[model samples]
Every structure is written in C-alpha cells, then in structure tokens.
Target: MIRGEVIEAAMYEAMHQAAVHLPPDVEARLRMALAEESEPLAREHLRVSLENAALAAAGRGLVCGDTGFPLFFVRAGSRTAVDGGFGAIRTAAAAATARATRDSFLRPTMVDPLTRGNPGTNLGPGMPKVELQFAGDGDGLDIVAVPKGGGSEIFGTFYRMLYPADGEKGIKRFVIDCIRDGCYAGKICPPAIVGVGIGGSSDLCMKLAKEAALLRQLGEPHPRADVAHLEQELLLAARSLGLGPMGSRGVNAVMALHIELAMTHTAALPVAVNAQCLVGRRWCAAIDAGGRIACTGTLPPRETEAHA
Candidate 1:
C-alpha cells in the first residue's frame, strides 16, 4: 500500500490550485453570457465581470472579498487509508488559504463569533466542511474543494410543502418562490445560477443543492424525459426574471436553474434552492489506488472559452 502521506500532500496541492483558479470559472460563465446575451447592458456587465476575473488571475487574489466557508467532498477508495486523519488535511488546507490570503491581500474573514475577536485563521470548527464518501475502489481518494461565499449562499433557501404529490409545477413554483424571496433583498448576487434540491430532508436538501452546482458536465437533465422537461421549463422561467447579472434589471439574469429530486415520505415535499454568484469557485480532483489524483476546476468550464 502506498503511504497516506503521499496522498495527503497531493490532495493539498490540488486544493491549493483550486483556490488559485477561482477566477477561471467566473470568466468562462461571463464570456458565455456575453455571447448569448442580447442586451447591451448585460453584455457590458459580463465584460466587467470578465475583467474582474482577469484582474484576480493576474494579481493572484480572491476575486471577491468573501472566500466563503470552505468545503471538501472526498471519495476514498477501500484499500487506501488516511494516516494523519482529516484534521491534518484541514490543517494543510488552512495553511494554503493563509498563503493565498496573504498573496491576494484577502481580508481575514474568519473571526471568533463570540469574543468579537479574530482567531486570525480561516480554520473554524467546520469552516472547511469535509464530506467523505468511501468508494469501493483501490487505494486512492477523490477530493472536491469548494469555497462558498455568503453573498451567494444567502440565496440558499428551504421549504416544506404539504406533500410530494404536489408534483412538478409545485416544485417549480417553490423554486421560483425561493428565487423571488432570496432576491427580494437584492443580496443574492444575480445573473445567478440556481440549484434546487427536492424531497430530501432540509439539511440534505441544502447539501444536494450545493453539490448540484459542482456538477459541471452533467448538463440539461437527467436521462428521464419528465425530469429533463422540468429542468428546461424551470430554466426558461428563471431567466425570464430580468434580474440580469447582479440583479441590475436586464434579460438573461440567470444562466441556468439546476434541480435534483428524490421521493420522500407521503406527507413531505421538501425543497431547497442554492444560488451561486457569477464567480463560482469550485474544483474536483480524483485520487486512485496509486495515490494519484487530479482536479479539474469546480463548476463547468465556461461554455465559451477554455483556459490554456
């Protein structure tokens, strides 16, 4: 068996790269919008958005002030073992974040909520929320790192309907309602990419919705016809909101509205909407039995351009 330390070091490098590439996804999505957007204002907004990403990349800093509470989703193979445990992985991550913060001049957003004093480190109890999945593969692991900012997360919402029999329209309406409520405060950071999770328990629903944002290539729909139809229809309605990038009031405010649904108890119809800002910073890397792993950026590559 390969030593776990090798696996840990590789994962750390991947996570660090994930943070560095934060602006790539943002730039891609904005460029895609610019191509498809009809409004001059929306196009201009996308241009500025792209420019911000470029600046971040060139300057090597977080594109936004809120680096967000970090999250790690790990898939570990059966034969592989974690020698230092997850705490070690998290410590390494905080060190990477500290380095990124200093290099980027990002404000230290992690402070003790009680003493009103700053611990000065981004490492909170669960700040780097780690989710581990044990896959029955050889000795390796896969890690997905996401730095979720609050600006977009405030738009995340949950609801419980009378029952699941409320069906598709009900689910659609519930999602639209979430977007409406979230944006009512104009803080969701528009031209938003919305993720909806239906039928899971409230907490699970929220988790699924955020996970949905990381599903970059699995686009448009599930293989099921009815599910695909609902995805397309809801997407159209969401874009119709005219909330355009940053809720500036223009067309194509939404890039996509993604949904994941599951059956629940007879009396439950739980739903959640997880919204994302224009700069979606997410990356996924896979480690196999040989302690080898690689990360593609989190979220889909911009539909318009690919980074060299």
Candidate 2:
C-alpha cells in the first residue's frame, strides 16, 4: 500500500519541478527554432525564452509569471492501494498546489467564477483538475502534471457532428482555420504545439487533444502511418499560413502538430484542437509497490545532470 504522505510528497516535488523546468523536448524545439529563424525579432524572442528557461532551471523563478492551472493525469494499478484511499490523491494534489503557491512556483490562478474572489490557496470548485484511469494489476501509480496557461486554453476549439465525407480534408480545414482565426495574434503564444483530436465524443475529443498537446514529446509522430502523414501535412499547411513566431510572420510557424484519433460512429465526426505555448511544462513520476518514486521529464539541469 502506498502511504498518503508518500503520495503527497511526490506530488509536491512534481509540481515544483514542472513549474521550474522546461521539458527537454520543448527546449530542444525552441533551440532548433532559434537557429532556423531569420527574423531578428523572432530570434530575439526565442533567445529570451531560452534564457528564462535556464533561469527557472536554476530555481531563480518560475518559467512564466502566469504559472497557469494545475492539471493531473493519473494511471493507477488495480491492485495498488493508498493508505487513505483514492481521496488521498486529491488531498495530496490540493496540498501540493497550496505549497507551490506559497513558494511562488505557482500563481493564485483559481478564483470564484461568479465573485472573482481569490481564495489565496489555489483550491476551489474545479481547481486542480484530475483525470484518472486504471490499468494493470501491479501495485504502482503513475502521475503526470501539466500546468496549462490561460492564453492557450482560451484559444482551444471543439466541433462536433461533421459529415464523415469531410474526413481528412475536413479535419485539416478545421485545424488550420482555428489557428488562422484565433491564434494569429499570438494570444496562445506563437510557434505553438498544436494538438488535433479526431473522432470520439465531444469531451473525449477535447481530452485527447489536450493529452496530445501536453503529453507527447515535440516532433514525435503518431504510431499509425496515416495519422503521422496527416500531422506532417498539417504542420506544413500551418507554416504556409505565415503565422510565424509570435504571429510576426516568420519561417517556423509551429513547433509541432500532434494528432490523436479514435473510432467513432459511422455518421458522426468530432474534432478538437488544443494548443500549448512555447513554454510547455509537464513532469511525470511513478511510485512502485515498495513506495519508491522514479521521476522523469525536466528537472533542474544541475539536478538532472547530477542524477545522471
């Protein structure tokens, strides 16, 4: 059985790490963009982004001032048992968010929608959203934390009930149109990681889109050849739109395009688009039956190197 305190401590560490470190894949993509960018302004922006990432890695401050919202995706083994039960995980997450706020690793982003009152601690209705799934029979738990900023979330789009005849062409059109119309102003941060989820119900489509945008490594292709090709095609098309870095019109319009698909009803097609800014922040960890934690995906450079 996993102790409640152990889960809480692991979650706290994950939250701080995610807030302060830029994922390796994201940093690499930004560096590659910097090398390819010709526009002086865009190049400068990329440079500043890298510098900020380096500073955050050193624990100087958070990668972004906004710090965004705390989101967790969890996979728990069927046999795994927590001392305080499943509710313990939620309690741990809430306490982690509060600590992150106190340490200034996270901003107080949660507020009462109606009153707009700040709760000081990042806890309230719908705050620290958690999505859970059960898998396998081993006594273990896996967790991923994604801190999504307001700008990107604001520009996300979902559409349902498109004719099956639209198919690939229709999906491509929806994605490109969303970016051109909603993201051209760099509201979601340019050279963004765009995720397209096709098929499934409305909610599932959006969830898949988010997972694609936030979980998958940059430039990694989907396993299916057809989906991979579609990702490349969309990436090319988005670049051709000239909505380059920060929407200032440059060569690199997108960091990557990831697509996730699921089988749906014969007549119904649902699609969703989700975006992640250049600063994509996520970290993951797994706790074994023995209560040992193994973590990955972007810690401080010094810490990572030392661990290596």
Candidate 3:
C-alpha cells in the first residue's frame, strides 16, 4: 500500500517547490514576453520578475508574496490501495500546509470568511482546498499542488449565464471585457494566463476555469480545433487592447488563453473565467502502489485537461 508518510513527504516537498520555483513553462513565457515588450516600464517589470525568479530558485525567497491557496488536486487510481485510507491525503495536505507556512514558504493567508479570523497554519474549515478525483485504473496517485495567488482569485475571476442566442460573438465580447476590467492597473497581475469555461453548470464552470488556468502548461491549446481557434482569437484580441506586462503598454498582455467546454441546458449558456498570475506557481508528484515517491512536472496533461 502507498504509505501515509510517503504521501506526506511528497506533499511537503511539492508545497515548497511550488512556492519557491516558477514553473519552467511560465518562465519561458515571461522571457518571451520580456523580449517582445517595448514599453520601458513594462520591460523593467518583466526583467525584475525574472530576477526574482532566479533568487527564489536559489532559495532566496518565495516566487510571490501571496500564497493565497495551498491547493492539492489529487488524481487517484481506483486500483491502488492507500495506506491509512484516502483520508491520509487530506491529513498530509493539512500537515504540509502548516509546515510550509511555518517555514515561510507560504504566508498565513487562509482565514474564516465570516469572522476573518486567521488560522496561522493556512488550514481552516474548507481551507487548503483539496480537489480529489478517482480516475484511471493505474496503481498510483498523482498530485498537482498549486499555491494560487490572491491577486488572480480576487480580481481575475468572473462568471455569468448568457442567452444561448448570444453565440460566439457574445462569448468573445464577454472575455475581452473581463480581461480589460480585471487586469486594469495590474490588479489581477497582467500578462496572466486566462482560462475560460463554457457550457457547464455555474460551479463546474468556475472550477473548470480555475483548473485550466492553474494546471495547464503555458500556451497549451485545446485539442478541439474550434476551441483552439477561439482561444487564439481571444488572445489576439487581448493583445490588440495594448495591455502589457502588469497593465503597461505593449503586446504582452496575456501569457496564454485556454478554453474548456461542457454540455449544458438547451436554453442557457454558462461561462466562467479564471486567471493565474504571472508567477504561475504549481508542482507535481506521484506515488506508486508500493509507496515509492517521485516528484515531476512532465507528466501527460490530465484527461480532463479539456472537455471540448
């Protein structure tokens, strides 16, 4: 069976790694944006970002100050036997989040919504958000740890239901509006990765958008040709708006735009938008049935990477 310690240790490492290291794909996009940007202020911001990434890589500090949500997306296999049962995953996540906060890899940002009480451990009721799924028959568990930032969640998220008649034009218009409003003055941190979810229930649409933004590799397109084309269209439109890194003036406004779709009610179309800040902090690990652990980011994209 996959031992609890193995899971805990892997989560511990994943948490810090995600916090401290900018994912290679994200860094590559940033470097490209920096190369293409012309505005002096925007270029400087991009340069500073890369420098900060280097320092963070060298153990100097976290990639970003707001480790907003220490989330664990666990994709487990039905055939695998987990030691201490599947509850061990949540236990490990809580423990890992606590330690990460204590060690400064994560700031204590989790709080009670009603009382605004600080837990100091980044763990609270429904906190350290864990999204679990049982899929595939392989004998292992794959965890994607994302320390989602507050800037993105608070300022860069959107949802609405549209008349099905609004069609593609309406969807495009809404997405552009979201980018314009959310990324203004870098409130949501410009040059962000945008994810759009269409046709799902309200909550599922939001979750889909979030997962697409956080878990996707930079610039990866949807497999469906129509969806991919729409992504490209929205991306180009965003660039034409003259938004640059951190809301400055240039062509490097969006790092990437991804879309996910699902079948919905015949009369209504629901849409959601979520963005990941330029930091794009996420790390992955897997544990075998025997409890052997391996940390990696090169795994194939999730089967649910795109629904349409």
Candidate 4:
C-alpha cells in the first residue's frame, strides 16, 4: 500500500503550481480581447485583468479571495492500493489544501451566508469538494481543482426543453437570455466564461457544465466535433450582442465558451449554463506512486511579458 504523505506533498505543490501556471490559450484570449476592445470602460476592465494576473504571479497569492468551493476530480489507478482504505484520497487532498491556504496563496472565501461571517478556513468536514473517477491500471493520479466564486455562480441557470426540435434554438436563446436576464437583474459580472451542459439529466447537466470549466484550455475543441462547432457558433452569437466587458459595451465579452454533453432520454434535453467570472482560480497537479508531482499549470498567466 502506498503512503499518503508523499502524495500530500505533490498535491500541495501541484495546487500551488496550478495557481501559478495560467495556460497559454486563456492568456491569449484575454490579451487579444484587450487589444481589440475599444470602449473606455471595457478596455479598462481588460487592463485591470492583465495587472491582476501579473500580481497573482508576482506575489504568489491568489488572484481573488473567493478561493471558491474546491472541487476535486480524482482519477485513481486500479492497481494502486490506497494506504488506509478507500477514502485515503480525500484526507490527502484536505491536507494539501490546508498547506495551500497557509503557505502559497488562496483566500478564505467561505462564510455563513446567513450571518455574513468569514469561516476563517477552507475546510469543512467534506469541504474542498471532490469528484472521483477510477480508471486505468498504473499507480498514478491526475487531479483537477477549481475554485468557483459566488458572483458568477449567482448567474447559473438551467432550463428543461419543452420539445426536442427546440434543443439547439433553446440553447442559443438560453445563453443570450441568461446574459440579458443578468443585465436586467444587474448582477452577473461580465467578461465571463460560459459553460454549456447539454442533453444530460438535470443533475448530470449541472455537473457537466461545472466540469467543462475545469477543462481550461481555450479552443481545445470538443472531442465530439459537432459540439465543438456549437461552441464556436455560440461565441459568435454571444459577442455580437454588445454585452462587452462588464456589459459596458465592446467588441468581445466572453473569453471562451465551453460545452459538454451526455446521451439523454429522447423525450428530454436538459441544459444548464454555468458562468465563470474573470477572476478564475483553478490549478491542476499530477502525481505518481512515489508521491512526486509530475506537472502543474493554471488557467491564466499572472502576467504579460512584452516581446523583444
């Protein structure tokens, strides 16, 4: 049986690296948006975003305090036996998070929604949420951690399609409709990432959308070609609406659109849209049997380097 301490160190480093390593694609999208954006307000937002990214990296601190509810995606190897039992993974992750909260950088965003008080730590008996999937036979682990905040989450919405033919049209409408709805209601922070979950049961659809955000690489292309095409179509339609950064008005609003799907009952096509704000804080760390970290990366780079 493999020990947990070695795994814990690697996981902690991974979470740190994930916070530091913003992937290239997401960075490119933001840089391009900054260049193309014209309106004073929208452009200003872009500038702040760039600076914030730089600051997070330089300080090695979290970009935003909304450290988000930690979501864990664990792919455990079949041949590897966990030290204590079936649940050693959770304990390892929580241990990693405690170190992440104290050492590197991440804010304590948890609170009592009713009392309006800070919880002081990111740990709950089952906090730092996690989802596990077991596959393969090697003694390795791949973990994806995402910190989802409240402002963007407040805009989350799901709609049950009344008819089958309405699926595509309904999706388009729901996205545009949700943004519009947010505009009218005046909350969803703009320049958001939209995750669309299609054709899954209600619960599955929601999970698919949130998981879609963790996929992270921009324009990575969905494995199912049709869904990939739909993502492009949605991007065009969404930008054309003039929602711009913070909905103040510009050429581009959404940085990217991510879509995921599941085969569903023919009678129903349930869809859910999960919105992620500009302050995206997610990282990934891979570990092996020796408890050594393999790789670490983040969704956006903390800074922009000028070309020579």
Task: Indicate which candidate wins on lDDT.
Answer: 3
TM-score of each prediction: 0.83, 0.93, 0.96, 0.86
Runs of candidate 2 with Cα error greater than 4 angstroms are 298-308
Return whichever of 1 and 2 wins on lDDT.
Answer: 2
Off by over 4 Å in 1: 1-12, 22-26, 84-107, 113-116, 136-138, 184-186, 218-220, 298-308
Instruction: Tell me how far the alpha carbon of residue 44 in candidate 2 is from the true structure, in angstroms, after superposition.
Output: 0.9
Number of colliding residue pairs in model 2: 0
lDDT of 2 by residue, 1-308 (tens): 89877887778778788888888888888999999888888898789888988998997878888778888877786799988789998988888888888888889988888899999888988788887767666588887887888887876554555778988778888898887765577778877888888888888888889878887878878877999999999999887886667777686767999988877888888899988888888888778888898788842121111221
Clashing pairs in 2: none
Candidate that beats the other on lDDT, 1 or 4, i.e. the better one: 4
lDDT of 4 by residue, 135-169 (tens): 66667777777666677776655455545878688
Residue-level lDDT tens digits of model 1 in 212-299: 6555533446455776687788778877776666666665556666776665677787777788766666667665556566667643
Report residue 270 deviation for candidate 1 (angstroms). 0.5
Question: What is the alpha-carbon lDDT of model 2 when measured against the actual structure?
Answer: 0.81
> Global lDDT for candidate 4?
0.68
TM-score for model 1? 0.83
Q: Kindly report which residue stretches of model 3 are placed more than 4 angstroms away from their true locations once superposed.
A: 304-308
Error in Å for residue 269 of model 4: 1.0
Per-model CA lDDT versus the true structure: 0.63, 0.81, 0.87, 0.68
**Full ranking by TM-score:** 3, 2, 4, 1
